[model samples]
Target: MSFESEESKKLGGIKLSTLTQRLAYAGIKEQKAALSRKATDNNIKQIQAAIMLQFGKLPAPAKIWANVRHKDFTRQVRNFMWKSIHSAHRIGTFWKHIPECEDRGICQFCNEPEDLEHIVLKCRRPGQKEIWALAKELWLKKHPSWPVLSLGSILGCGLTTFRNNNGQPLVGASRLYRILISESLFMIWKIRNNSVIKREGAAVPAHEIHNKWLYAINLRLNFDRALTNHAKFGKQNSIKTPLVLQTWSSTLMEEDKLPENWIRAPRVLVGTEQQSSHHPSPPPGRRGRNR
Candidate 1:
């Protein structure tokens, strides 16, 4: 959509060049205003250059900033780029709002708040240290040039899914990276909540969080596996059955003798039988049965 709409003009003084540029500019202005400062001409110009670097050069800064203010950018840039530049400094401050996380006096996991850093970086949870270490190790193995070890860097790198050794995209690497980062964040969040809200003195076991992270990564990578194998793993893990399971289950039930409650119902039996059938049933009946 064009960023030069009448509504955008009314909200901000100028019309924008492109929707993306406008959106980026608007974000910077809004964040500056939210912090109780105006984006002066000089600051606006600098930000315009930054935006250009972030996204190619724009026709005009005023137009781009207007769009950014209106929040017209895509989610990827808005969440990752726009917010990263403006909100990164506030992360520690943001965590303070999490009740159990407020006191920086002691480590949340150890109840020693003495020198607690964010759970993602320096968690005191029982096995968290080991898991973080392993995550860092794995990340470095993929990105040896990365210098520091911090949750933000790890998360940022994972979200971007930086290129692999051969530069040919690693199949499912981006998804796997996201899964790893998400699992790590979730575990850290849970540990914080358990320590602060539940008053649990015990730290979250590192091995458990590591296993969870690994499971998430594996699941993302193996998403295209055969239904039978997926179901087998799902049942073993007690995870909910995916939609494919239901569709394949009814067809195969006649042939396969899988435990009735398997989460990822096997499709092998059903698919094989269907292949041998001379006449497949009507669509309506088949659809209803599958459902």
Candidate 2:
């Protein structure tokens, strides 16, 4: 309550700007450090348990966090994954304490309290189901069968490892999984927001979801292609050409017709089987349309 400490007052009183600045900075740093000392929340504990159950190995919290921020992930994806792990999204129980808005926590289709896990993995909603189906179809092109996925696996995808017959890391395949998981997860979230906030909870059409997913994957392909330009991104920063090719290898349309380096190939599309009957067959020599 007093403006002056005896020593400070002797020096220059409490009006001493330099001392005041130092004290304020130290208090801020101490408060910041206190955040790390707080106990982990149930959301994080659940994610850790899910990771162990799905992966058969548990990672430290720091490693999981680092994996979420992998450079392969786009900025929005990194943020999404981070928020997912922290359960920072204002859904489900976040609405429970609000008097009239508690209904917002309930899924219209599932009739269950809506949470990230339900939205991304278990929702019968149009977007979640269609997005995962498209992701699986594209993934099947690379592997014999898609790995069983859970919310934990999807969130910690960067930490997921793939190995070939010789036990060496399947770098391309692993990278591809991360990209697919992060992209698909973000798309699901965006569609849910659009449906709730823009459409007043109307379900997006399945065919539109399919087309949007196709565009998303093909756009990622284009991004990978652009990153392969060593001169544009610098040799150190650019993704390797072969790695990009391997990541997308069998998934593209007309794989047999493309040149050895299809990075610059035109009109590339992921060659998944179309789920919509009305979709036209791709023109000869051009597989997936990049819309």
Candidate 3:
């Protein structure tokens, strides 16, 4: 039955069933908007100054979601990516700006300022560089022409482009790119929190970080496999499985269940000679120093 000509749906005591509720909701929304405006306008300039100094102008809204095809990543990881894009995720440098407390904003491992970029991409804390280097290597293998990563690009590279050297569109690779960057960033955030919060200054090893990365990617790859595996094999498959299989079968790996191809980023041997001048090893006795 049409409700337009009848009494509206009602709830306990509230005018939820009627146009009155709509008016109430509008009033509430307007009040919230006005309060927010008052807050920003009347507050000290520190909030704006801090944002301008560190993250710069707000990033433009993402023009695309390159991972629209992939559905295996968790809601939490996606949320982290959303925050990372605008540089809203917390880091030591952000804490240092608060007027109530004194934080030096230095990275515990590198002694450099611990900004979001440093923690997510360049942190020399036990596991960070190795994890990122592995992420970069795998990303390059799949997308050899992708530009060297910057903090901004790491967060939003999926929307940046999907092309190669000749500018031809690289259609499906964008999904893989999204996983590589977002998963790597998520792992780094975990490592950072472990060092700062849970570990209470203890270092997390590179291999441990590598293992977590492995577990995460393997989980997603397996989910993708299950999706693309046909009902003819036994169980119901996702509707998109056929479409994904058409493009995925020959590129990333040969075997249907093989995760090694997609999760191939290697773990850095903590003290290996690969740690060079630019990414120098810490002195003999320092925590997280290779060898």
lDDT of each: 0.42, 0.78, 0.55
Model 1 per-residue lDDT tens digits across residues 1-291: 755757665434444444467676887678757653331343445445543443344326445334332221223433433343343423345456567867654554445433213545565555455455444434443344423444333333332334466766543444334444444554555555665457556554444555555554334323523433544666553323443343223323343467654444443221121112244323432222111
Candidate 3 structure quality by residue, lDDT tens digits, 1-291? 665632345333344565475777877678766754553332223223332343353332223243322353467777776554334555654467577643546787788878777786677677667666656545554554435566655655444336667877665566666666677777888888888889986887656666677666655555665554456455554535543442233334334455433323233111112332245434433432121
Best-first order by lDDT = 2, 3, 1
Ranking by TM-score: 2, 3, 1
Candidate 2 clashes between residue pairs 3 or more apart in a chain or in different chains: none
Which candidate leads the pack in TM-score?
Answer: 2
CA error at residue 11 for candidate 2, angstroms: 42
Top candidate (lDDT): 2
TM-score of 3: 0.56
RMSD to truth, every model: 19.4, 9.2, 13.5
